[model samples]
Target: MVFKLTSVLALVAALAVTGNAQRQIQGITFAWNPDTPNGSHNLPKNALAMAPISDLNSKAFTCRTNGLNFPNIKSYSSTGGEMFIVAWDMNALNSTDGPKLNGPCNHWMASTAAGTDNLKWFRIGEVGYSAEEGWCTDKIRREGQLVVSMPNDLLPGEYIFRNEVIDLTYAGKTYTDDPTMGAQFYADCLKYTYSGGKNPKEVTTGLVSLPGAYLATDKGLLLNLTADGKPPGGKYTVPGPALHKQPNPGSA
Candidate 1:
């Protein structure tokens, strides 16, 4: 179980709508199934009851024309639930022009704090890398055979495997008024519609895209995710369902 962050290809094409690469976020959507039975493989009630847990913010990974190494990939498990992973492409921040591909998106590590230790670990292979805008700053690519792994020992709740792209109306501070990320981007959380051990090709064809809504965020997308991706436990969850339903059978 290697929960790595290798997404982009599957969802970016989801949006048929086009936008400027700058100012407006372009080509991004939740890679989801369009045929799975609704209410099936829903997130655990508790997973939806909580807020997204993010320990870090505004990270950038860049790769140069000469190709750079993404040597540091890190992750963290929150007390709230869900393990958050982050790493740097190093190639992201170098030039506003963007990254040079056909290089390395190295295996990486991350830390809970800004130091050499306490950083969580993970691995990635059987994949390639690419970039747009800023490989690290704008949007990046994890070319062909993209598969990000998570620890098999994940908590039994709703989880999302997607990147967040926050957009702030730089009214004055640009981002200060809104220190937000993932303002608008789809989460293929529905992909988790089934169990987590199989290859994505095995179970995700007709499943509808799960609205990036967290079963937690009141915005929407609240549902159940069985430990086995089945129903009953596959029931839908409403806001604060976990508030009264304590000690639900889910985590991660």
Candidate 2:
């Protein structure tokens, strides 16, 4: 009886862990197809139980779990200046699981390379904190969506668009102090193809590579979150490269 009870308790603990780990990108509502969007057809593949990829050097930091799962490989066509609604997959009971409210949410894009390794990525949109809406994560939780705008002057080609949320709740400590006690990164990506634009030029500047774009010691990632759900000093800089400015920025 003692052994059976111990096994049951272990199982319960494992179940709780699994429930907590279900935060990931589920589907993206693209401009072309709102009904059958990016990950809607691929249910489990898009909604994987991926934990935060803390190590900046890890390849999973690029796309988290679906980095290499390019089975469908179909690109949704788009122009630019469109709003893409991204949904997070979480356990029903724990819908508001992670990507803490004090952090920033960012969007990135990379031209399709041979593989998902070492591709150059550039930030397209980001929101950290504002007196109007508070933290971006809070807005994300309230709306139950992460909205990203496609660049207005992006060159015509296939690209991998990604959405990422950096949880800075415990970023006050360095990874050197404790491996799992620093910032947490959660991201997922899908493919898109751009066609016509106002004056589209290939993104040449402000491109950064994953695993190298962010560092554990960066000023933006080392701040401590206060009880008010903001970093100390009441200032926060969104990490990653600046959004490349095009000629004519359009409406979302």
Q: By TM-score, who's the top model here?
A: 2
* lDDT tens digits by residue: candidate 2, 1-252: 012333322322222222343556655545333434342233344345367777777767777764545323465677777655566533522465444435788888898644656689998889888777877777665644565667777777778877788878778887767786788887777776678566777778999988799888899888778877777777778888878773444432
Q: Could you tell me the lDDT of residue 176 within candidate 1?
A: 27
lDDT of 1: 0.23
lDDT of 1 by residue, 22-60 (tens): 211122222122122231121222221112221122221
Over 4 Å off in model 1, which ranges?
A: 1-12, 22-100, 106-119, 124-151, 155-252
Off by over 4 Å in 2: 1-21, 31-49, 70-75, 89-101, 113-116, 246-252
Residue 90, model 2, lDDT: 30
**Clash count, predicted structure 1:** 44
- List clash counts for every candidate, in order: 44, 0
